[model samples]
Target: MVDVMHQEVVALENRRRLYTGLAVVLLIAVVMSGYHEASQLNSGGFLQGLAKFFDYPAQIVAQSWEDGWAFWALFPKFLPALIETLNIAAVATIIGALIATVLSLLSSRNLEVPAAMIPVVRRIMDVMRAFPELIIALFLIFVLGASPVPAAIAVAFHTSGALGKLFSEVNENIDVKPLEGLKATGSTWLQRVRFGVLPQVLPNYSSYFLLRFEINVRASAILGFVGAGGIGSELSRAIGWGAGNEIAALFLLLFLSIVAIDQLSSYLRRHFVGAESFG
Candidate 1:
């Protein structure tokens, strides 16, 4: 009986290995095929362009070094644009979190939402998340005539859907005792959630909101590339005019700004999540 069981285990192990090997091979083949197709569709082939990929960056860096003063000079010129990008991100995050808070409660199974409406609301969030922020920004830019307004709207729309899904999951893990206690006191649904659910999930919600703000900051800058009015638009124009020095300067500023925001957000998230875990 022991011999028979040992052989069966070996066979199962062999079959698992066989399946894993096949999956890996299939994944590699798919990746290669996708790369080949992308290269063919691209204006420049991958291998051909790969060699020159660093040429632009190299040139920009050398030019920046040669004219370091000019690089510093561009900061004052672009300060307002950077501020605009930050403002866009802040406003969008606030708006998105506000909307998401409501949607999350409605979508959460633990809440008292109508069963039939849950799927409908979830689908709406899915639609919002499905569309890329860039696509939304461009569409809004066409309608709104190219301003930070469109960028903010695009980021907010996506953020609400994304955060709503996360917030619902957080709601699922919350203690039901508070909710029941509130209900026994004749509290309305909204009152129960506000007094019970909000306290439990606020830290998690805040952590997500800060993360989204970091992402929206980057998105806002990218949206500016499409003429949404921010540093990105200026960077696009500078590149278009072949202003290598200015491009380098803008790149430096962008890099620094992103790093600063990333560090600050990371610190806040750690604190918030840590506090929630302790509580």
Candidate 2:
């Protein structure tokens, strides 16, 4: 009996290894074929493009170095645009976080007031998340013309869906005792969620909100390239004119701003939500 059982285990192990090897081979074949097709479709091959990828950056650096003083001066000149980008990101994140809070509560199985609507609400969020911010910005810009308002709205729309999904997951893990206690006291649904649920989830919500804000900052800048009105628009113009020094300055500004926001948000998340939740 022992010999029979050992043989069965060995057979199963061999089958597992065989399946894994086949899967790996299939994955490699798919990757190689896809790469080959892409290289054929492109005017320039991957290796050829890769070789000259740094040429533009090298030129920008050389020019910026030659005009180091002007590159530094561009900071103050572009400060207003940077501020505009920050404002758009801040407004979008705040609006998105608020909407996400409500959507999350409604979709959470444990906290949902009308359980029947949970699926509907989840589908709505899924649709919202399916659309990228850039696509939404383009459509809005067509209707609204070039402006920061459209960019803010686009970011907020995407943010709501992204944060709603996360917030719902957080909602699912909360203790239900507080909600039950609140319900026993004749608290309304809204009251229960506000008093019972919000207190427990606010830390996680805030952490996610801060992270989304950092993402929105980058998104807003990118949207600006499409006439959404921000530092991205300025950067686009600089690139169009082939002003290497100006391009370098804008890149530097964007890099520094992103780093600063990332550092600040990381610290805030760690301090408020604990180190484990920082990610």
> What are the TM-scores, per candidate, against the unseen true structure?
0.87, 0.91
lDDT of 1 by residue, 1-279 (tens): 999999999999999999999999999999999999998899989899899999999988888889857679889888999999999999999999999988899998888889998999899999989998899998998898899999999999999999999998999899989999999999999899989999999989988999899999999999999998889999999999988888987888988999999888888888977854321
Worst 10 residues of 2 by lDDT: 270-279
lDDT of 2 by residue, 66-171 (tens): 9967679889999999999999999999999999988898899998568789999999999989999999999999999999999999999999999999999999
lDDT of 2: 0.94
Residue 119 of model 1, lDDT score = 93
After superposition, which runs of candidate 1 have C-alpha atoms over 4 Å from their true positions? 1-48, 274-279
User: What C-alpha lDDT, on a 0 to 100 scale, does residue 117 get in candidate 2?
Assistant: 90
lDDT score of residue 237 within candidate 2: 98
> Candidate 2: TM-score?
0.91
Candidate 2, after superposition: displacement of residue 4 in Å?
A: 3.5
